[model samples]
Target: MTELDLQEYSHSLLLEVQADAEAEGTTTPEAFTRRVLEDLEQAGVVANTFTAYHKTHGHEVHGYGVSDSGDTLDLFITDFHLNPLDSKLGKADTETRFRRLLTFVRRCGEGFGQEVGESFDAYDMCAAVGKSLTEVNRIRLFLLSNRVGTWTDVSANELDGIPVTHEVWDLARLHRHATSGVLGEPIVVSFDPPLPCVSAPSNEPDHSVVLAVIPGRVLAELYAEYDTRLLELNVRSFLQVRGGVNKGIRQTALEHPGKFLAYNNGITATASQVEFLKDADGQPTHISRVHGIQVVNGGQTTASLHYVMFRDRKDLSQVSVQMKLTEVSPDQLTEIVPKISRYSNTQNRVTLVDFSSNHEYHVRFQQITRSLWAPAKDGSGKETHWFYERARGQYTDGLANARTPAQQRRFRDLNPTSQKFSKSDLAKYVHSWHQLPYWVSRGAQKNFNEFMARIDEAQPRVDVLYCQRVIAMAILFKAVDRIAASHGAGSHKSMVTTYTVARLTLATEKRVDLDRIWREQAVSTTLEDAIDDLCPRVMHVVTHPRDGAHVGEWAKKAACWDAVSRVRWAVPPTLEAELLDHPLDEVVAADDEASSAARGEVTLVSPEEWYAIERWAKETRNLEPWQRQLAYSVGRKLELGQGVPDTQVAQALHVRNEAHRLGFRLAS
Candidate 1:
């Protein structure tokens, strides 16, 4: 917030960019832009396909991401400067850069790829944009810079009749985002005519509830403008399925518009602030505007409204939908928003792990990382913690909490910035090692959601060994990234890295001795050699897409992984020599054995408890049919005064644990 603080953040960010550039053998500007894009992507400010392209002509594009719906295109341009944290980006320079990016978009729409060959890095981006031009309804031009500047807001314009908006994320803005833990800028919605709403009586002082019947047409229009920003708190994206809720929504909108209110579950929304339009009698009559409005639930309904209005060309004049808007205070936004989202989505198939940053898995993982220090690497003689940022902005918040420079330095010493990894980073590493490179390529947030779903189902124990293996995977991923960069992977660096690691994991059959890597705090030279030998093959498969498809999009497909998996590259003998004799299962079994020993003896449940558990599970519908049957069988065995097998006891315990996780409360 202060000038000194901004300068410090800028300097730290610059250093990080330089370090990444050095590691990847890339230019500082390229690294800086990539880092910024990664932050924005994780923040949900942008979607997938982050390709870097630069042109020397009056046109240039640092990077771009197409929204999940393929209707919004985000174009990024950066003005990165070396040193001089006090440097300022003026309006003239900003406009010049903006125009250059605009020219690039215009050229793409005008089929500029025909002029340049496919060998160029920008060719794929230009071609993809050109192909999606018809579907793209909005263009967001972002100006990323490390310099201090007064942002001159650009009014929304049209690009080939499609709406275009401009935004700038300068040093101060990035610093604020890093520290504040908020996802991008707040979306302020101003109603032109204002809608009537009734305030719900709430005794709570920190928040207020309002009920409104929003016109379906107005809701569609709002979604058309805000898109996913309105659903930032929502866990899922637009399902886009023809059946289920989407189909029913479309049918209701078309056949029984007036019944939509009675048929639909409506939407649960939250906002930081709201303005009321009051009458002369000092009674609030209309809701005028909302600040930081996010639909925590009913994202499907909101997106369906937009879908029907645009894709089906259906008039929503007769449709009205109910809405419950909770105006939360800024102080409670972080604490209450996720709870609101979680509880509202419980009725759906969404589980507790869907909103899982604060889940026990991550909490235990974070605790393990904090307590378990990694071995000193490169003769540093001092161990460091691989800080697992379970929540966003935690590492920075930790540094901020240090207050003084000395404390901050000690904090950095104990937890190096390079060692700091977020939940998405962990997901990417683990998923790549698990041979799901396609999932890794699906962007951070989505891939993380998928990974969390798996964690929810598997319920893997998070212990010291698990933390070590995760860090080992992280080290492997980073090593591959560096190798890919050194080999001039260019825009395909990420895909190449993930695929190469995946191929190695597959070739080795999950026997790579992650414990050794964890002990050394680095990868073996033989393993690095194996990765180096396979990087070129992976790059070839990634760069040469069949039918000349976009490499980025191709990498996100299972077929891409399939093609890479079938490559003729074999694991080097030396690398194979480094692999463990048994698979990772053996290691996990050993850990389970030690964990079991630590817990002493497993107490067998009494027949009464087994019967109670079975009854509770059946009543709550928490267990699958097979699990319920197993529980019932065990209960029957206990009732018959017959001994139950240890397996059956374990099964019953698992069922009980799962039921507890699903919120099946029992009388103590």
Candidate 2:
């Protein structure tokens, strides 16, 4: 890390800062200022660059730092200014003003150069500059207003240095332990006021859309705030503590037997367990893998669609057609994708056969005449298909399942063959859970009941999602607040609305391409208001990992922003040395297999509890005086052997015949 030191340009700026009181001097200085400007021009400066002209001998108003955001600016012609309120140097005589301005400009350039040389280490200096960097942005602003030189040919690596900062490191640290740690992580999002449900027109058939897992807080905030107001309702969080959880960590850990021991193990990472952040382009960008939370392998460890996208087949004559596959989750692909077509314009069909099944796919390809398409929000939006389709698949259970003679008669009436079946008939062809025709059965009730059940199990994720959303809102609010404080934006609401709309419209996934339409006609305030209104209804099924962490960073930017917020963090010190020696796999094996973090099981102890345990172990001596070598149990400290040895606390409860305390039902 390079230390901060003022450079030559900084000195020039400093001189201008000094010129606030300095009277303009001789015309000789103006000549000097003009020559410097000429050299800067040769270097390709885009902004108002302060140049020293030995001939004219003074600084002059070059360009102003131009921001397209339309924020008001008060400018100075003679001196450098950090703010608009600084005094102007134009009051002095023309020749004198020009001369002093030239002197100040020279000073700024020399000072900036000095600082660059002294303050930065080779690594801290970027190989190149990029728009993402705050320093580059500062340069951009200076060029717009001052007689700044353009960037001639800085390499890409130099540009990258512009954005690097300690703050970036701070924000990145949270994502390391996302999935399993106290740090928010590997989020399972199920949107409430479901995205497409609200956006879908009444007439359109709803299709599931994919929410691809993105790695950064940027995308995380985008998803959370896209419709935040709608998300807050009935939202919950998953961070409740264990028994006597309110007690400090040590006390709580002591009550829940062995929990702390497991924690000590989990935090100790081996070479394979850690994940680090990548750049926006998904290339590794961190110093090392410190902590990590991985995406769960819940659905039988299937690979991501991204990892193995189906492309070319062996048969060239199959007539390939490009098609977009969005929501291709294993469940949806397994259960519903047999009905989906590979292409809407071509005669090729694709079937998602079970990964374990050996069944052959039967595909039918068809062509249709072009028809008028519907609009997005209109009630007459779409009556049948949501998007285009080309082919279909048929998979039937055994025909032998039908009664012999009656099956033939029913088959004759229904006819085994039709060029194309209607939606209702297609539904009938698919078996129903009740053994009736699927469409006729109106599985709506069944589907709704299943949805409710899922809600019951997945609610913790939703709570986490809500907290995440709150964090995103707070961060965006802070960024906007800072930006607006610089601008004249009247209130927090107005500033947020403008930026929010811009951010959402850019980041959100829409059924119809909003960006395409937005280019033709800018977003309406009504749409912005609609989005704001929708925020409370947008709920996710997990804790807020992204948004919460980001907001914390934002609030940390200033002491006033930080307020009195305190975050409690922990690491298993005992496991720390272990992490250095063993692999993560070994550590995980040693921790608790307690799947339910909700269960009470903290059996670790603090020094105070350790004292109590040793004292109790001394008192609770085992039988046989000669058998002093017998083990002493720290039962009282564990507080576990309770209630017939049931629940997690049972083993430590010390009841001799705990098995008799509970019973199992006998077979009838």
Candidate 3:
């Protein structure tokens, strides 16, 4: 065969392989789609969870992802035996397949939060992310297949309701994106007639400051188009500081629309490129598409505009807000982006820890990891050290310069499993292990910032022991993750994926005698065996939800941990020998003994409220048990003033209202 023909034939063979694999097990396509969708993360898509089901309401959804921004994606991975557009196929067959896809989109849209799918409870999934049909700004239907084709029928691109958009990710497209390292196009915000703007040159010619009066309606439209992608990390936190409409911005917009520019500080935005539509005399007419749009400041104003217009359903045609657009060249993005984020966000301040990577915690972790050595398994006297990567590319750079065999061995000693653990990974594993999956699910950067804040409040100074504990927790998490993957592939391949394994880890951690486990300074073989035993129970808890609770929400919060921790599992007989003579046994035993007396006082939720809560939960049929449980926990915290100040009263009230809507009752 000719080279081109050979290439085409090889493509056909690969598609056949994918089709065969998918048909053999339900997880094949789910896993494949997950690997493919992970690429979207580079494009700024922060997905919290993935769901895979054999069938969702009599339709095979294959898999889907729920983003942190409350957007839902319906994934369909098609691995057909024959190409639908083959010459042997009749026109009728093609039409039928196309119409079937349209039906799938409609079905997915209609069944948004329903639990008819094989994945986790959709209702619980939506509730955990605070998403509802009304709140879901967009529903993306992604059709992925090995066979290449375009949807020439433009009419079938979107569903009528819920702002649904369709996309096709064929094998060719996936290959290009994966190989080229190119991101999807940045958002383009255009202003017709080129709204008048003034420009000031910066230090670099490629970078300039353009001041323009953007229509409030246009800004809201831009927000709707980009969602959370537009907000810088710090800006997202600032907007989330309080709930409900900004009374000041609202009053000004509602009462005096004309004074919006004068009253507001306006939004500060960054873009990779900006163009102006100009007249013959070179006077600017309006803005063309502003590429790579990001809001470094004025996230409140941007979000407030969307909320006021879409949520409040208010008119914004008469309102116009000011915008300072910083056009940045691609080459200077790395250095300039952080600076823009820092200076533009003066009103809603962020700290050095939030933006910079040169924090003391990272330096301390590097020291701890380098100083500590892993236990020698074979009694060789030689031990491996865990290389805690404080910065990106540090490991690779070190390995590249290794000249001697000892140096090479040193490089290898930094175990690969633990090598990639960054501060973000530390935040994720620690929070998820400690029963804070909700924060972990909020995207890595957001979770890292929160974890840093917690560290600041709880332990202003880092110590060796605390760093050791963090490292130990990460090791355990990694061990569990590997075991889960092995089990999924070998035993329960159809029912498990990495994401499910994470959820299962959270459940298993509840059953784990943390008091006992923590005593062992390291993740030893005995703890691994214990985790293996706990996996079955974790799977049971995940697949079966007691009391009709929202399992997803329960799993995300500490309430589930509080419930599961009450149960104590005896040591598995098979691992008793290993546990008895474990190297760290004495230390662990000492810690456990010291903490045993105070265990009862360590409850996160007050035991005093149990009777009243149980009665209230039993009486309230409107709310899911999980909702009741969550509300009670929040209520208890409110009573205890658990870090919540009077300033957070409005947000607290909003939480209460959400709980009530979900069927939690108000106290008389």
RMSD per candidate (Å) reads 7.5, 29.2, 10.0
Error of 3 at 161 (Å): 3.1
**Candidate 2 per-residue lDDT over residues 1-668, each given as its tens digit:** 11111122222223332331121221222322332232222111211222221222344343222111111111123222343223322323323433343343334434422333312221111111111123222222111122121222222111223211100101112112211111122223332222211111233233332122222222223222211111111111101121121122223233432342232111100111223344686543332221221111100001111111111111112111111222333334333333332121121111211111212111110112112111232253422211111121110111223436477345323322211232222222211111121112222222222222222222222222222222222223333333332332211122122233223322231111223232222223443344443221111100112343311112112221112111111222332322223211111111133323212432432223423333433344311221111112333334545221222222222121111111111122
How many Å off is the CA of 620 in candidate 2? 40
lDDT (10s digit) by residue, model 1, range 158-182: 8889888998998888888888666
- Which pairs of residues clash in candidate 3, taking residues 3 or more apart in a chain or in different chains? 194-285, 194-286, 194-287, 195-286, 519-588
Maximum-lDDT candidate = 1
| Rank ordering of all candidates by lDDT, starting from the highest | 1, 3, 2
lDDT-wise, the better of 1 and 3 is 1
How good is model 1 by TM-score?
0.85
TM-score per candidate, chains pooled = 0.85, 0.17, 0.63
Clashes within 3 Å, all models in order? 0, 108, 5
| TM-score leaderboard ranking | 1, 3, 2
Question: lDDT of each structure?
Answer: 0.79, 0.23, 0.53
Which window of ten consecutive residues has the lowest lDDT sum in model 2? 298-307
Cα lDDT of model 3 by residue, 1-668, tens digit: 24343334334334434543443343445445544554454234434434443333334444455554343444443443344234222334334444454455455446544544435434444333233444565665555555444442323354556656556665455544433322444567676746788777457776888888889998888766666566643334434213333557877787888888898889888888888877898855567778877777787788777777766778998899898888888777656766777777645444433234556667766877777765544455555665675654355445546756577455656553233456666777666554455456444555666666544323323455555555566656656655555554322221222223344344343344333434443456766766676655554544444666545434444444444444345656654544423222111111333233222222343434433454555574433465455546555664675643322222233333333323343344
